[model samples]
Target: MLIGDVARRSGVSTRMLRHYDALGLVRPTGRTVGGYREYSAEDVRRIFHVESLRSLGLSLKQIARALEDPAFTPSELVSDLIRWTEDRLEREQELLGRLRTVDASAPTGWQDVLRIVELLQGLASTSAARRQQAVLAQAEGVPVPAELLAGAVLSESDPNVAGALRWALARAGGDGVAALTAGLRSEELDVRRRAVGALARMPEAPGAAAALADALGDPDPTVRRHAALALGGRGVTAAVPTLVAMVVEGSHDVDAAEVLGTLSQDPDTEDRITTALADELAAPTADSATRIRLTQALVELPGTTAQEVLRRLAHDEDRAVALVASAFLGLIREQPPEDGHDERP
Candidate 1:
């Protein structure tokens, strides 16, 4: 079929199809005389597989390599993936811990974070070693080389960290990931997390996503959270389904739901996130705090889908859940009860 037809049938975009082609991810089986792409049924299924893995956090290059080698073993991929996964989890845990502490009525300060941010901002403007050290001391416990630290906050380019990352990418290109990816995993857990954070700036790699996926299975909850965050940065829609599933299994439901929200750009993907949230509401599996958090996320969605789902949950035996759902229905529709109106027989 043509690109539009394939997009309608497969739920993948035409632009992505071309990207897959460039990466040898999904090449058309044949070409039309007019030079348009052509695909077979098998090609469509392959696209689904590509979509699934991309969702699972594999990169295009890794996807290409995996396709070339059919005997691919998950065990070999899982090991290195786990190492970096721990790093990511530890860092997100630190940030989350601080946030939770602040969120709780605990007397605390973001003064530390603000200080760190200010110091990094100072060093990041220009390359001055003495000034960088002064800033580093003030921002103690802040990762050194504030430039890279800055980029770790995002997956995009920053003048602060670009030079070193270029050298790292070059070294990885020449010596391969064994020397770079593998060694970084051995650093202190926080440093490792920062390294995974660095993956934000670099281009996607098949293994990086896979590694992030494996990290989702880490024994620690915080590690899994960071893994989810890292996956969001590099992953495609393929990560959506898994992310939805994770929402149910997550020990930290609020965090999981928030992570899923980031992937809700596409309708199909957004539907999945909403559906998962609905499923949780319907089941009453989440605690009160979790349900509240989930409901807030539902309200934040772009449509009435979540509200509709809550109405369905009104059938539940748990009066609290049903009552909550009913209350949500009233709020979502932006109405209040009428005095003796008798709207319902």
Candidate 2:
């Protein structure tokens, strides 16, 4: 293609083409005998790339280096572009947040411009405030006051919504219990589990124990697990006998044991877990991960049982168990001069 055609196709002016040639930014293929520049198809491609970088807010000098660098791989250049975009976005968000603050304080005449500026500012922000705003908005079921929720993060909520629900369940009386019972009959397992567990937490919930027993028949493992746990947490003696039976024969033996163990301060769960672990260890085969988990759980228990097991596992023939036990023991020990027990065999 000729220089005129290249300029027309690339949208670069003729003067800029000459300047690019001078700067070695983009050059023509060759010159005719009359000395007029001629650009081949490759020249047109180069002009569009330079134009794209300029659109990204890259300086002419930076774009020149990027275009000229021989060692720059496509992936490396793309990664650099991503980092540049993220940095630009962060700066933009900070400006937007400031603009939001400014907008709330602006006089009537400046309000329209401030709104436009705030809208534009997010192009640079991290979008963190937007996430916080959405979460707060969800919690309130309405728009959260930006001034009060400013800089509030996702960590400020969630993970605790269910916990607060439990508190409500703990205090609700007859009518609340009835509503929760109806929730379990609803098709949604999430609604069922959340309501049931909260209902079971209250000491005086009407038929809560019966509702929970029915939930134990629910196909969902989570609903069964939470129901059993809530009953255990409340130490409702009515469920302990059933839990003891499950500890012996149910597929959810471990889940039941775990709930019981957590409720150990109020009920006798450790003995049941100990017996189950002993039975599992007696079997010719057990999943190694399960054994590992059981070992760690036992080690966490205080008193003679934990200490004796720690001593046994500390020198076990299995390399993984021995290494873990040795590492744990080393943390609370003092080196015995040059001959401490840490010495290699």
Question: Clash pairs of candidate 2?
Answer: 89-124, 92-124, 92-125, 93-124, 93-125
Backbone clashes, each candidate: 7, 5
* Cα lDDT tens digits for candidate 1, 1-345: 887789999999999999888877899999999999999999999999888777746777776777678798767675766776788899898667445433432324566555544544554455455333433344223333323333333222443453444434433332222222442354355544544444433426435565556556545455555566657645455555445545555554555556566666566777877877777655645776556556656654554566566666665565666677677666656643356443321
TM-scores of all models?
Answer: 0.38, 0.37
The 10 consecutive residues of candidate 2 with the worst lDDT sum are 148-157
Give the CA lDDT, 0 to 100, for residue 127 in model 2: 59
Q: Which ten residues in a row have the lowest lDDT in candidate 1?
A: 171-180
Off by over 4 Å in 2: 1-171, 185-188, 200-206, 236-269, 281-285, 300-311, 323-345
- lDDT score, candidate 1, position 190: 51
Clashing pairs in 1: 55-238, 55-239, 57-209, 59-206, 87-193, 89-223, 155-200
Residues 156-271, candidate 2: write the lDDT tens digits.
Answer: 23334445434433432443555566677768766776666565566356677777877767777666666666676666544554454454444465665555556444324555
The lDDT of model 2 is 0.57
